[model samples]
Target: MRIVAAFLLLTVFAGLAIFLTFTSSWGSLLIPQAAANEAAVAVEEPTPMPDWEGKFVVETNQPVVLRTDPFVAAQAAGLLRKGEKVALKGCDVSGLWCQTEAGEWFVSYMVGTLPEGLPVLEGVKVQAAPTVAPLVPTADPAALMPTATPAAASVLLMLPTPTPAPTVLPQAIVADAANLRAGPGTSYAIVGSANFGESLSLAGRTDNGEWFQTDGGAWIAGFLLSDPPAGLPVVEPPAE
Candidate 1:
């Protein structure tokens, strides 16, 4: 009878021990899960940004310098060729400036006229300069007198080989105050004044870098380094 009573007591103690072990395990798991849920609620996720990429055409065919700051004289960044295409990542809403992928700012006024449609990631076509035609034989009435001799008639029959006219080159404007004189020298009388970025036909220049003119025309010159003035559209020469 004593042995039976001892076995019953041991069995009850074992049952109690198992119950306590299960309860402790359940509590530990619940606490960790609750803590994890709280941490998840406290942390917030960051929002994603938009991706905008496109090619833009320069509206004006003017020389534009890229700047580090919005205002001029901040820092010498770079120069943009006229009628060049730029890949725009983003821009300032003021419409006064645009930023390149390299983090350079360029003024809006210096752009050549952009194409009517916008293109993405592909080739952005731009206007190119026209090619001049080859010079042909032209009759000079002053030189063309009726030949009396057979040799002269034969020469005239050769169609009076036309002489090529001197080719005219594009002129550079004075970006600053420049003096127009009888010759390419400061000592030459200042017949006219050239203001900033004034367009003048280049006659020729002295070896010392002084510019001259073939035609006796006056222009404005200056010392200021600025992009072409705003509001002037790119002028396309008439087609041949």
Candidate 2:
């Protein structure tokens, strides 16, 4: 009986020794050198980007390649799908390239910007506007005004035009039921609506004249209206 009990005690000690040998520093000797070295190293963190300047959405129909640099020839870091929202750092004044918070760049035209109803950017490279001829011959604007006599000037100061004709802005009718968007394009958020035949007070137009900006700072497509009065003031689209 004493010899059997000693054998059981020896088995228990041997098992414990085997477990400790595998679980302790001694186990490293049996491990592959490369894996052991990798386990010893800490992962390096990525460098941080600057605070976001604004947010934008991917506007392209296909996946847009995120370039390492602003140029199209730059190495591609990754891809962004259409309509993917991204927070940007900033864009160049020329509006060619925009950088993201992830340290990647995308082409300016491939991203959603101001609404579609807004006029095309003047200097920015966008869809090429068809060439429009000069509607009227250029003349000295100052020479066109009639020279007022002293008596007429005095009367004008006393009683400005009895009507608000001077204050009245250019107006357009909603020939078709169209949406009034916050920006110039259909891609912009809809803020209001113009019923059929509703009259809209016009404030400005985009450079390409494809959109008309309302007095309330909303945008509607130029094609959505009847003939707009000539000499509508050309204005820039509001930043979204």
Candidate 3:
């Protein structure tokens, strides 16, 4: 009888363990309620949309290049005029590049939203604005104006004029190991290697305007360098 009682107790416990293993309530109890709610929230959330409207107008501070890809090293597909308009297709996650309906890509920051009041498809016509004539003071009004004394004029002239800051020409710095060639095109022989952050003075640009020549007499692909610094003058390339 004692052995039978011990065996019955063992069987009861085994059945209870098997029941809990298959029970949904047992699994739910194992997971915190907060965790389950958080997971449901994650599944229901949607991705945020891009900031751009359907159309974008090129309003760059400087001319921007349209590229085959979103990266700077991509081939120069074309140039987007400063005020040209383009249809927005999509943008990269970084929001730095936008692809156009024509399948070309450009920097997104260079574009601005099309003004709501402007016509979307109309060609812009620029007309010379009528000039307004300057108003001249009458003799009576001119008499009331104070004239500068010769002594005051001399004092103003003696004041030292501030010296203007010298213009700093744009320099190209290598972002990675890059080949410096004898000419802008890759067909030219490589003359040296430019290490990361190596600075080179601007010399000139290729006829196609795709490559830059350094003062060091080495040519680097313009796309390989960071965005050409503002105010960098474009020089004519040397005769090939």
Candidate 4:
């Protein structure tokens, strides 16, 4: 009878050990899977960009090549300007480049060249503006008077009208690596950036040497219209 009792006790102990081993192994495997799933859920999503399109400037001195097509091996058709506005189509996140409407692709450094006064397209489509005519002065002083005024009142307009300030537009450049800023001084904020071998427009300037024009839909300053920096190449725009 005692042998029978010992055998039954040994059988019960063996069954308990097998159950514990299986339970521990299953728990270990499940815990890691649960932790992995939690980690995946904690990750954040990427932000989306606007659907509108416009231009960007080159902020570096390095020569950036733009091909007739987006592929690298495509024939080199044209060059870009520093602070020059090119039509942007969309952003390519995987490639880290902006694809221009003209099918040109450029990196971020090339797009930061202009900061302030850059024209923006927003969601609205706009036609390119007509060139502004130069303001010319007339010799007849009396002709400057308002026509709606009485003859006696017109004579009182003797106060010489201040000469209209010259309407200077920003000039464009076809070089690589231009600068853009809020003001003419280097201390001013670097509101824009650019890449190498880019062309740009010089709209106007201040006496302090600050340049102002549209860069990527905003106004920025850095380069001037006077002279191209030494070692930089300049390309003329195709004839209209």
Candidate 5:
């Protein structure tokens, strides 16, 4: 009888211990799991630039000149204030002149430190000089006539090729939707894209006239554009 009584007492104690273990707050078990799940999800924030301005600008007290082309010989397109904001399209390989979204070129420098890399073009020329006409000698009209001497007869006359007149403004209509490439040929990689019927300003053309460079320094096939304005300065093709 004593042995049975002891066994019953032990069994009652074991049951009580189990009941105490499980009866604590039910939320204690689920709360940690929910907290762990929330911790696993991460929220990212954008990195902040302390000195970054929304747009690029020249660091000077005077107004900055905007040119029609990248070269110094190009006429002034307009002017921008020293603190005026200007958007950048891209820069030439040399990174000297940066093209603006407005299709004009400007010198690339800022008041703040320059970013690690400027958007330098891979296949582009910094300057494109136009062919100049031969100068006429300042002499009498009779002196200009060819003489009977053998040396005078042998001198080859160089005639200047007339640049064709553009029927329209220095712009073109896109015939089809396509990307503007980096080079003159179709094999080149695309730098930007053009939509069908979109009008783009023309900067220049390849020497053979097979490619046309838009004002933004991107190249487009000559055939893709609708009758690009003539007399454009022949630009140098990108290296192979």
Candidate 6:
């Protein structure tokens, strides 16, 4: 009986030792691997920026200049007043510069989302450079005196008068029924309408030549009209 009890105790002790060794080795190896897997799962990719579209308001204290190009050194195409509403066309890859539907470019930092239930900003003013008067040469007092003979005066009077160059004003007749919009693009709100055979005075054209501004301050698609006048100046449509 003593021999049997001693063998039983030895077998129990051996089994306990094997179980502890196996558990210790597995815990040491698997615990670090589990921690590494959890850490890898916790590290995630960054979130992307939201795609912004629609009308944005100029939130700056002072007026901001809209440029013909996206860069700072580009020509000042127009001025955007504080609290004015501007239609956003798209933004650069960095989302810093935004282009208007009218094709004017401005910095995105100066603009903010237009809030609902608020009256749109007013007193928006455009600054155009004053036209300079042509200088006239002063006439000499001696030259003013009648130094020519009667025959010379007769010959000068007989000389043919110079013909003036013809001025060509841009005009267009609507070939089809068209919608006159507030801005140069079709996305702008329809402010007026044009019937077939309606004649409109052309003031300017959009940069892409796809739209034309009428003398009535409305925009119409150029494709709806006959070919525009050859000498008409291209003007930048105001940002809506």
Identify the leading candidate in terms of TM-score.
Answer: 2
Query: How high is the lDDT of residue 136 in model 6?
Result: 53
lDDT of 2: 0.65
- Clash tally, candidates in order: 18, 7, 0, 50, 0, 0
Query: Which digits, one per residue and each the tens of the lDDT, describe model 4 over residues 74-124?
Result: 345566654455555555433334456676654434455433443433342
- Roughly what TM-score does model 2 have, to 2 decimal places? 0.34
Relative to the true structure, candidate 4 has a C-alpha RMSD (angstroms) of 16.5
- Between which residue pairs do clashes occur in model 6? none
Q: With candidate 4 superimposed using the best TM-score fit, by how many Å does residue 125's alpha carbon deviate from the native?
A: 24
Winner of 5 and 6 under TM-score: 6
Q: Write the per-residue lDDT of candidate 2 for residues 1-240, one digit (tens) a residue.
A: 999999999999999998997788666765677676777675656789644343443345434567676543345587677666666666655565666767786666555653323222243333333344455644655565567798699765665443322557778877656678888765789899888789999987777666788989899876556566556667777777
Write down the lDDT of every candidate, Cα atoms only: 0.50, 0.65, 0.62, 0.48, 0.65, 0.66
lDDT digits (tens) for residues 32-121 of candidate 3: 877989888889957895445646534554345678876555566877665656666666554546677787876554567533433322
How do all models score by TM-score? Answer: 0.27, 0.34, 0.32, 0.24, 0.31, 0.31
Worst 10 residues of 4 by lDDT: 229-238
lDDT of 6 by residue, 148-236 (tens): 68769987677565554543446898765677999976557989999978889987766645568888889986545654543345677
Q: 14, model 1: CA deviation in Å?
A: 99
For model 1, the stretches where C-alpha displacement exceeds 4 angstroms are 1-54, 57-60, 113-240
lDDT by residue (tens digit), candidate 5, 108-202: 54223334545675676655434433444455545555554666544534434345444342878876565688887656787889987999988
lDDT of 1 by residue, 79-142 (tens): 6655555655444544445566676766544464433443222232221222234446666755
For model 4, the superposed segments whose C-alpha errors exceed 4 Å read 44-47, 50-240
Query: Model 5: which residue pairs collide?
Result: none
User: lDDT at 37 for candidate 3?
Assistant: 91
